[model samples]
Target: MAERLHDPWLVAVWPGMGTVAMGAGYYLMAKLGMHLWEELPARDLFEVDHVDVKDGLIQTAPLPRSRLFLWKDPNEKHDLIVFIGEAQPPAKSAQICHQLIDLVRPLGVTRVFTFAAMATGLRPGEHGRVFGAAIDRGTLDRFRDLDLTVLEGGQINGLNGVLLGVAAESGMQGGCLLGEMPQLFSQLPYPKASLAVLEFFATLAGIKIDLTELESHAQDVEDKLETFLSRIEQAIHQVEGAGESAIPALDADEEDEKKKPKLSAEDRQHLEQLFTEAKADRARAYFLKQELDRLKVFRDFEDRFLDLFKK
Candidate 1:
């Protein structure tokens, strides 16, 4: 028998450009402390085309696995189901989506979401803008309200786009969130793009999860990329005998800081109480983590927050 879930929203992800989709999916799974719910049989859909060899001996490899992780909402608003696939099959993507829908529909999933990457001519230091594409008008309106760049006419290409198309055919409400990344670095892991997608998704789903770790990682990548770009620009300038570098600096508006959430005295007290409870019972740590995330102070208490799980 399938486990009963409350108003669950399904978010599916697979390996793609910039690793945006998979990064967000894994982060959600870790922060929410979701457990493995089920494994979708993949042998029919995914066939191994190559094998590894050790000491000139061919070794058989297992087909890629597709898994589902469940996070029951503490607020009873909506449970979350994150589907992570080890690899996208070379063919029959639509059929795999059909199988996925059939599996989740019975568990009361009405809305589906997929994360993807949009390769653009963006600078490495620039913030990645999230693009939105919906299966329905109502969801489109929500995207507009969020000020997301609506994908007017383009192909989303791959399972990230195909799954939403399948969901629409099955009368499901869903959309795809595409994070903008540099076309030149499309093959690189862009955690900034992943962070941008997750920030929007967290708002859309009304779920709170600590994103400080992701944010820090994104910042580190941004700094490294900036340095790399600067060196390349300097080399180009020397080659061209130019008086000034051709690369433009990032706009001041782009560097503006986002306003942090303010916490009340009551909220502070509540946080302390939650921390105490979490210390006694490790299972309560997720709830405390959520509160800390909501207040945007997860970094301040990160060490202590992680201490809850110390055995």
Candidate 2:
């Protein structure tokens, strides 16, 4: 059963782990009870991810779950709690967040902050990035020291996104700490992404965590990934030199192939036009929403001023 979360001063976190041991050590410390507080759950995050449930396949969706860790300071008043994970939900990404609100609201939490990484397409020889956003002005102000930039066109499409929405709906303050990572590293869990996420988390949590172990683990993973890439490149080079495969043609248009008993030029043009229109329409709709939001804010201010002087 889902825990009835009370109103907690909850901290939501979702760091990539297990795929490689990069950020695993930070999680490990929390596991070893070496920190200021002990994890309330008898189980760890990974176990929670792999726990089995087979009830005739009525429904079996993995993830969209969170790990709850709680610690109480004997002399302090409120419990310090952290929630970690991505919830399973649609682009509206909300289901798991509802569960978190249940757990924290009952516990007296009124704030929810999530952690994530912003990925980027980087050259193999270039550096990475770290960025963030917040749902509350105060939360945004607090993390300003992390050198966080304003996310102007920000929208959440993942679990972290949903949690932020939960915070918004519940009138709770929320924020996200993100690390910019390479797109090439997107295929699997990237250690660089893990490092960026944890370091950023440490800054906000005010929790002193020694990342030395995590760093060592990240180095090992990085070496392995680099080796894998080198092998793949070498294999591709060998295949190309053998001449079994021809280079992809950039000029093979429908007009050239139409008379050869294939698709007509008109059909190909129609398909391309359909795809182009779909992409343009999606982009236009997104911009329209932004414009509407900006206009609404201005209108709200104007309405307030009009009422201010009214008898």
Q: Indicate which candidate wins on lDDT.
A: 1
Give me the runs in candidate 1 sitting further than 4 Å from their true place. Answer: 241-311
lDDT of 1 at 41: 85
Native-vs-model 1 lDDT?
0.82
What lDDT would each prediction earn against the true structure?
0.82, 0.49
Worst 10 residues of 2 by lDDT: 302-311
Q: Could you tell me the lDDT of residue 169 within candidate 1?
A: 94
Model 2 global lDDT (CA atoms, 0 to 1): 0.49
* Top-TM-score structure, candidate number: 1
Candidate 1: lDDT of 82?
Answer: 91
TM-score (C-alpha) between model 1 and the true structure: 0.77
What residue pairs are clashing in model 1? none
The local lDDT score (0 to 100) that residue 149 gets in candidate 2 is 59
TM-scores vs. true structure, each candidate: 0.77, 0.55
Local accuracy of candidate 1 as per-residue lDDT tens digits, 228-284: 678778778667754455545443323313455457899889999998987776556
